[model samples]
Target: MASPQKTSRKAAGTRAAIRRARPASGRAHSGDAGDDIGLDALVGHAGYAVRRFQLWIFQDFIKTLATVDIRPTQYAVKNVIGANPGLSQMAVAKRLGIERARLVHLLDSLEERDFVSRIPSTIDRRSHALHLTTRGKAALAQFKRLAAEHERHVAEKIGKANREQLLRILACFT
Candidate 1:
């Protein structure tokens, strides 16, 4: 076995190397030895910054709605269904960019929760039209209130103006 003193020295050296590798903000910098290893390099990269921001926003949304047990995608699907009743499953899937098979499973879960209903479509007997249940309408209202609170948290973090600007810029991509 290695001596405790030797282990301590090894650990200390490892910690020091980590400190050197990380920025003052304590986030790990990703780059090769010759590259600038800090936020300066990361902030200049749009995709990386957007991904990091997306993760932060998603985590905040999940935490804020933990009590209601709604994820971001679920909330989005619910909102669309609530707003447009009798939309076909395919319509919802295409609108939200969810895969058809995946949407079927998602709809199944929502139906099991008594939050959504799938009725036989009059125009296309093979397809199911989506609708929110009475319970779902009530739950959606609660979800909206919670989502607004989450938005407020986001606004506080990035400022309302920046949030609005971010939305506008992101809208271009979608």
Candidate 2:
């Protein structure tokens, strides 16, 4: 009987022969065997593919926002302030999943742009309430329209049904 090593080598040789007998390609196919993992296996952990797709979507969004001179995070901040007037900075930070310090910086930029104002809360001097200035509101309205257009474009690319399912899945993750 053949040694186990010999048998394994023979089997591998037979497989290689069979592969070589098939059509030859112009592409060079030299690589370590471990490098040939399937896409699903490579990006399937914890929905890595989904995360990658989200990144692509965000890239498109950032490009769109660039035209309007607004960043995606900035739009998010403005929208939250628009929806929740008198919202506390801490509350905004908590709801938006932004760190308190980062939120402060974001608020500072908005304030500098005259897009938002921080007024002292009537109930607490330490906590400031947030409000959108008229300019801010107008800017938000424009952002909303642009966002709607971009959303529709993305939805068309991903299909309406898949878009709904994606939103549901993302909500569950968050």
Best-performing candidate as measured by TM-score:
1
Task: Write one digit per residue (lDDT tens) for candidate 2, span 55-105.
Answer: 877887877777777877889889999999999999988888999999999
After superposition, which runs of candidate 2 have C-alpha atoms over 4 Å from their true positions? 1-40
Predicted structure 1: lDDT? 0.88
Please give the clash total of every predicted structure, in order.
0, 0
Best-fitting candidate, measured by lDDT?
1
Q: List the residue pairs that clash in candidate 2.
A: none
Q: For candidate 1, list the clashing residue pairs, or say none.
A: none
Q: What is the TM-score of each candidate against the true structure?
A: 0.77, 0.74
Query: How many Å off is the CA of 95 in candidate 1?
Result: 0.8
